[model samples]
Target: MLLKDKIIVVIGGEGLLGKAIVNGILHEGGVPISADIKPIKDSNNDIDYIMVDITSKKSINDCIEIVYKKYGKIDALVNTAYPRNKNYGRNFLEVEFEDFCENLNIHLGGYFLTSQQFIKFFLKQGFGNIINFSSIYGVIAPSFEIYAETTMTMPVEYAAIKSAIIHLTRYMAKFLKGKNIRVNCISPGGIMDKQPINFIKNYNSLCLNKGMLDKDDIIGTVIFLLGDISKYINGQNIIVDDGYSL
Candidate 1:
């Protein structure tokens, strides 16, 4: 019960990683409010989610108001929404300038909007926590060889967006100096998402152990951040990649 009774909002609670994080929070005795455009399965309807479009300022503000009124105080905000256009995920060479910009605006811009809106709420409450998602790709360049026989290619837009998030976390943390608000990021290694066998094999070979992380593997880090154990750990990017980046 490390997070006993804490009211934490998971921004992308409907997504793969987001759902896992929410479950982990519940296991630790935290009350997690799912804030996503798509509601989680069933989601208890009324109390399950705070439906939101993170890209829209009004939607985010509404989400804040709803959660605050219901939960009284929001302890932490974990952002994992992966909003992107259909043109996204193209290879670097095939990525048009317009497509790249649009994806960035949708994904990265949404992150900015959510963080800004939440910080305003946190300020009024006197304390808050913000945990953002980055990736191994954000910390280091993609390994193109892993995708040789697969259709999977790292998108340029993803790199730019994730890397930018790292800096934005730091900027927000410093900007809120002595304000009792903490900002941090988690840069995870590749998770086991049923990708091509060749890619998985190549990726595993790079890691020291556990070639690819399970969703549960990342949960501990997030839980740690949400608890008082990491009170002093602010504006830092914790990489949970099993030495994959090494």
Candidate 2:
């Protein structure tokens, strides 16, 4: 019941991580609103869904308007949306320069616009919380050795965007000081989806305990950051990598 009666807006609510965060908020007795470019199918009725294009300032502003119109106030915002172009996942040498810039425009630019709009609303309301997502890659370079045999290699754009997010969180936290708003980031290690066995095995070997993370492993951090318990916490990047970086 950490977030009981609170209203939280989750961008990219249809993605795997976003869905887990939505469920986590509900479990904590908070109202979770899902905002994305597409609608979620077979979603719970308790969750509110809003369509938004983070790349557009109007769309971002409209999203905030919709949330305020319905809930009167937004207690927190969790930005997990990463809209990538078709050229994503390309290997280092295979990656095209235009594709890299496009990915940044859609992903990092989107986060910036959405956050800018919400911070204005938060300013008016006198308080707000923002939780941004980063990756363990942001903290340390990807171990190229891990993906040796697999078709997967860390995309250059991903590393750039995630690293930027961490600094952006710190910048926002400082800019919003004395305005009763807090901004923090979560840098999660690799989440265990159905990756190739070789990749999984290689990744797990570097971890302190379990190799890859389950989606549920990150929910508790989300809840804690969004709740009153973290009132004193701001401008921090909390890494949840299970010691993989070590």
Candidate 3:
């Protein structure tokens, strides 16, 4: 029970990766509270749920207040939420400038606001952990050849946002030096989500395992980062992509 009684707030807790992290926390004896714009159904009653709009400061503050009121302390916060505009996955050429900016505001801006707020609280408490999500695409440019037969190409905005997350984590970690708050990032490879067969094959060929990762593949790292075992780790981006970025 590495986490014991630690209380963790998981942003975007209703989604696939979020749900896996939440379960991992539970298994490690941590208390997890799920916060997202969408309501979570069919989850264990022990899991707390809160509707949150990460882009809204008011909404973010309110969610934190509710959690603090109920749990008295938040030991860690895992931001997996990626609120984006409707044109999120559009082709690069087709993506409108306005939509691109909007997506950045909603996704990166939300991350900034949420982290700023939590850092304030962490400062007061003298200890906190923040785990931000990044992607393999952030480290390496996409392989356009992989999508030859598919209508998919990595979105330009996605690359921008994910790369930004890495720098943001480092910046916050350094700024919080001696403050007892740790900030880190996890850059994961493409999780197996029933993507196009051709894309999957190409992606796997680039990886050491020659396979797309499963949702559970990311759980152990989450547990390690959030727990006391990684006390000396800070300001680092741990890539969990099975050498896919190579």
Candidate 4:
């Protein structure tokens, strides 16, 4: 029970990775409040659930207010909320301005807005933890084909936005060090349930992939970053790829 009674706010809790992080928090005896745009599953009733739109400032503000009113304190924040756009995979020449801005809003603006509001709360309380999400793209830039390979990836927009997030995490960590607020990112490898048959075929030919990818592979890194065990770790992008980026 490392987290024993800590209140954790999970953005995008309705999604696959988000849900896994929430479950891991629960397993460690932490109380989780899921904030997502969609209705959370009924099984999550045992924990707290709030419908939130990360793209809107008012929506995020209102959600945080509700959490503060109920939980009295927000100990941790895991920002997993992001947008999906078809225009993300196009070549540099084909990418549209609107699509790129939308992607930036979700990954970059969303982090700033959420952290801005939460930092205020954390400042008042004197302690907080923030675990943001980035991708392998932040380190090793992947191609548009790699973006199209799984739902997790996209070329210019996602990589650009997430790369910005890695820097944002470091900046926040330094600025908030005196206040005891910690910020870090997790760069997951390829996480997928079912790859397109064509993607698997191409991957096998070029990558020598032996087996299908699983969603559970992303869990452990998340657990470590969220717990007190990582107290000394800050402003770092911890990559959990199975040598895919090697």
Candidate 5:
């Protein structure tokens, strides 16, 4: 087992990606902790589950303490929490200040604070892995105004914040080098979820023009990063976009 007996934390654990990661960790024999603002349906008394608001410093610190209290040390932290901004649709102009800030806050501030709390433990123990979520959109510009058949579309702040997160992962990886802590990112393509009508219409058009991806496409990358095979692969952003950017 790659992560046998290791304690891992998956932030945004209530979401689809988070739940998938949690299950993967469990399958690998690692103790996966589900950390989120909302409790998941699978959250039980035996397994570790924490309530944390990534945007709040106090809440993050408290959750860190809870993790430390439950498990002696934290082996890894995978942040997959993202801002809820689909309500803006394709209208980039309608994306408000609060919405933008909220998205950026979790992608940037959340990673900084959460890593800050855990790095202390990692530094002391001399072993930790931080896996952040980036997006293929971070690497390639979104088709804001690409003329398909006859329409235009976009996803604004999400791509912006995800790009910022890639840099943050690099910074953390370089800063924690030789301390036995590693930082990396997973930049996945659009997940196959039942998105809103506007998003679906736009995405389908984009897919027809470009291509689409399935959720399972990310599984191999997730396993590789979480396992011991990637011990030396630090401070890198791996893009699993199925040539969406190509």
Candidate 6:
């Protein structure tokens, strides 16, 4: 049991990757509390689900209060929330400046707000851990050629937000030095969500092994960082892109 008896709160716990992390934490004996924008029916009696909007300070603070009240002490925080504006995912040329700012404000801004509140709590608690999610594109240039005939294109705003997350991890780790607080980032390649066949073909060609990873593939890293084994591992970006960034 890597995380036995620990209380781990996963923001965006209703998402694709967040769900896997929740299940993985349970498998390793940790108590997981799901914080998402919308409520999800509890399929498992072990999980404590709560409605949270990462974009709002009141919402985030309330979530922390609720989790702390129930769990007593929070051991780690896992952020997978990717809030976006309605006009998110537009092509570069079509993306307006306002839309770009809004996307970053929600996604990256939310991460900052939530982390800030948690870090404050952690400071008083004497220890804490934060795992932020980035993307492989944050580390390398976009493989635009892959989208050749597909209707999909990597949103420019996505790169800005994700890349900022990577550096933010480093900044937080350094800023929180000697506080027993840890901050780290994970950069995963294209996860195996349904996509155009041609795009998949192109993506696979650039990868070393698997073309795209599943949500479960990231759980091991999350478990490690949350557990004591990664006590010294902080301020680093762990890439799980199947070598796609290489």
| Candidate 3 overall lDDT versus native | 0.92
lDDT of 1 by residue, 162-205 (tens): 99999999999999999999999999988999898899999899
- List model 4 lDDT by residue over 1-246, tens digit each: 888888999998888788888888898899988889888666646778889887778888888889889888889899988667566666666778998887787768878888887888889988999988888777776744643645543468777887888999999999986788999998876666576776665444433354334566677777788788989898998876665666
What is the C-alpha lDDT profile of model 2 across 77-185, one tens digit per residue?
A: 9999979899899988988999999999999989888889899999999999999999988889999999999999999999999999999999999999799999999
TM-score of each: 0.97, 0.98, 0.98, 0.88, 0.85, 0.98
Off by more than 4 A, model 4:
143-153, 201-213
Score candidate 3 by TM-score against the native.
Answer: 0.98
Clashes of 5: 0
Among residues 3 or more apart in sequence or in different chains, the pairs in candidate 3 whose N, CA or C atoms overlap within 3 Å are none
Better of 1 and 4 by TM-score: 1
Candidate 5 Cα errors over 4 Å, as ranges: 44-46, 85-90, 145-153, 196-211
Candidate 4 matches the true fold with a TM-score of 0.88
Candidate 1 ranges beyond 4 A from true positions = 44-47
Tell me which residue pairs clash in candidate 2. Answer: none
- Report, for every candidate in turn, its global Cα lDDT versus the true structure: 0.91, 0.92, 0.92, 0.79, 0.78, 0.91
Model 6 C-alpha lDDT per residue in residues 1-246, reported as the tens digit of each score: 999999999998999999999999999999999889967955677788989998899988898899889878899999999888888887899999999999999999999998999999999899999999999878888989999999899999999999999999999999999999999998888988888888999989998877778889999999998999999999999999888888
Candidate 4, clashing residue pairs? none
Clashes of each: 0, 0, 0, 0, 0, 0
* Shift of residue 105 alpha carbon in model 4, Å: 2.1
**lDDT for each residue of candidate 3 in 156-243, tens digit (9 for 90 to 100):** 9999999999999999999999999999999999998879999998888888964789999999999999999999999999999889
